[model samples]
Target: MTITGVDHTPEVLTVRWQDGAATRFHAIWLRDNAQGAAFRHPGNDQRLFDLTEMPDDIEIADAQIVAEGLEIRFAPDGAVSVFAAAYLREHAYDRAPATPDQPVWGAELGRRLTRHAYDAVRDNPSARKAWLDDVTTDGIALLTGVPAVEGKVCEVAELFGFVRETNYGRLFEVRSEAQPINLAYTPVGLNVHTDNPYRSPVPGLQLLHCLTNAAEGGDSVFVDGFRCAQKLRTEAPDAFALLSRHRAPFRYRNAETDLSNRTAYIETDETGRIAAIRYNNRSAAPLDLPFDVMGDFYAALRRFSRALHDPDGEMRLRLEPGDLVTFDNERVLHGRTGFSGGARHLQGCYADKDSLHSMAAVLSRKSA
Candidate 1:
């Protein structure tokens, strides 16, 4: 096995392989991947190509050894990719090989749930943030002790830096009365799914607060859609790949408004890591694909949907009057069980991921 060598110096190093091949790597790539937020944030960060594509077709061209690192021209594209000597020495590229069959739910879910729970309340000065960080990995955070009020779920969401508005920025209401916003009857049992699949940029997070839950059988349900996707990848790789490669249409319309969009079942980050899952049977419109693959796609969708709805694969909880459940709308699938006759009023609001992340950062700084 060939061992990669690392050198630490003020200037970039000229690496020469035993095969008599030489190339100069600069500091730009190292600086961009820095753990510090100074290089990770949007406005203040350096721009680079997708990380997953880094190894492919990369070759060093003209090289300039600088005081801090090497300035090398990348081949073909002639783009500059850098590697800082100090940064290279500090970081290791040999990450533990990822286990393809590892389970991503359960304990892993608990950790993420806790982190979100901690960040959710670590900011509010007036509120007492008492929550179980192990609510589930599906991004559910419970905020307790908030004064229960009718039609004030938006207020609770606001405390966590979430703005109150619908996917379309229209003021939407949640009621048990007739004729709901989506033309679907109110208080019906909604499938475990994300909201506003029709919007290009679907709302990232959702907050649902219980004002009154005296009625029975309306307990909230959550499922880690990412976990389900991982399972699909393991058990049915072809189906998983097909879903990830194709786009499915989603639509939502009321008499007054109509919205639609197309997105894949598996969403990936810059590193090709699966980041989110948006599955909603109610909002799914007719898919546009070749007839042969369409049948298989629907079959795969059915199988995944079955897995999601399985009782063994879900986490169930009942929100009390003072309880507020906040979750990542993109990563978690949420639904309500059928409730019988009684006043089970709940109010909800939508917020973007950016706001939640901002809240987490502010809280982290305060704690720090």
Candidate 2:
């Protein structure tokens, strides 16, 4: 957008754009956002000065449209700042904020699940970017034709970010065990739930790669926790409010390790937008709410659990050897059916979402 004209007061500056839109910029905001080398670090774009150093009564002395963008002169200090036209439009605060691009889905997603071949993602930047984008938008993705070997899950994680090693080590095994330390090592059917809710900072992403799968009935299942939360928000507002308002405790303990955390079942940001979902029935600790609220809490919890187990909310798939799945650990609940007879084996690992997002952004810039 090109700036056509400028009108200003001591405190605010209004710019008229070529598209016939007018945007008002606060003098303090513009002063703080100066992108010049003297004001910000060129390498990282971090601000050079502290906010406390800025004059409290700063005002705009004058403003004008320049060839590069919009230029403003500040009073007192007489410092000149220029901003690109595109930058101003991109950061305009006068308009309503854009809705998040994330798309929530349920069992219907099974019909057209986001999928990418392992070899293609390894060799093609565009293919990897698309797959990462899929995981970001839908909270899950699948990869076929993986090597079906040990520790391959780590390699997939490296494509985006380093593995987040926990007490389970760099990569954990998944299969029936003689004396299972965790319920996940058993052959019994598991309920749809998030992983490691007991940790302070739960794993942001999870990768499960199948090395072998000859068991009779070990199909994998996924549920969109975001979808479940939204259903409660729309159908049971009181339940949703309670779940988001109160904290639930979760814990995991063994001989050498004991981890515990307390968080809202349905987490929300300052603007009340859903931020994350932490639900793990097996790991939840005893209730500690007030006596009066205990009954209501349990009722709300049951309603939320029902939403999670709704048949229409589940997507089921049977993984074959060489197949791998990646999902947002906080947003997608995973489980499996009981199996017996033949052997079934898989490898899993954890990683953070920030690194995945960083990789996607760099790839996008390179492609552009």
Candidate 3:
């Protein structure tokens, strides 16, 4: 068959054959030819194929565009291939390239948390539900008499539903060097703050288990961040906007790893509903915002901070050994009042929202 017209451009092309019917082709086809080495050993210098080796008998039998992409059938070989617009773009065979943002919960984090939830040692549905509701509404809950293993915060979370292990490990240890394992000399003072602001899907649940708490000074504190946020929204909407719109950096560095992230204090959903709050004075980086609004933001931030520290808004409790205290890392702000110079030790862990959701699902199903 004779060919009459063909466009020579690299990106878009028009072709006509013996039947005087014209068809268009994109230049990406030539650039991504299987016969080219670019598609084979992309970064390395490996040779892919020689164009001369392609059989001349191979010819296009039919071509059409469908909702998915271009469909093409080869003649002599009777081979068929559907070139989806998205697939072609993915293969670097389209002018418009495609790039998507990374998901909040990546595959690795998702898989790890799912496995941990499924393999939990102990399951506590009612307690898990209470823990979930308390954290969701008020941000904190105190669990007592749950068996504590050497390194199994997952078991505690599993009893509630599924524990979400965040960037923080399954179980974190906090024992004073002076007091050792006994409950003495360990300072109980901790600043109110959310855990791991740097993580996208910050751990939804934070569980602190008191293995030995005979210390004098270590009472735990919980602040309702959502309440504080609502106060800000009502008193100073502009300041709230500044905090929610701007990104603040957070860092957690240790010998094994150096993790850091920039995020906002108040996060909202698509409909502008308050979603999560990340307020950690210790981890907060210097505030950055429009010069004119910086003052107002700080003023509002100070007010919210003050409200969080207020006795009326906070729940204070001393965790005894064998007590498991869990809170919503997203909605509850937690801290410690420095303990007496006595001995004290606590173990902590990070688990994600999925586990909590799983636990909720199981309970709902059983109840239904």
lDDT of 3 at 99: 40
Candidates in order, TM-scores: namely 0.70, 0.96, 0.60
Model 3 Cα displacement at 342 (Å)? 3.6
Q: Write the per-residue lDDT of candidate 3 for residues 34-71, one digit (tens) a residue.
A: 32243357565364656555445555656555554554
Sort the predicted structures by TM-score, highest score first.
2, 1, 3
Per-prediction tally of clashes: 9, 0, 27
Candidates in descending lDDT order: 2, 1, 3
lDDT of each residue in 1-368, candidate 1, tens digit only: 12144343323334543344444434344433533333245555554335664545444455555665544555555555354544543353434434343234632443344323323454544222233222223366777555677656666566656564654352344447663555223677777888877887888887777777788688778887878888888899888888888888999887767889999987766555677788888888988899889889988888888878877667777777777778888878888787877778766778777765665555555766
lDDT per residue as tens, model 2, 210-264: 9999999999999999999988998989999999999989999999999999999
lDDT of each: 0.64, 0.92, 0.62
Cα error, residue 359 of model 1, in Å, equals 2.5
What is the lDDT, from 0 to 100, of the residue 262 in candidate 2? 95
Error of 3 at 24 (Å): 42
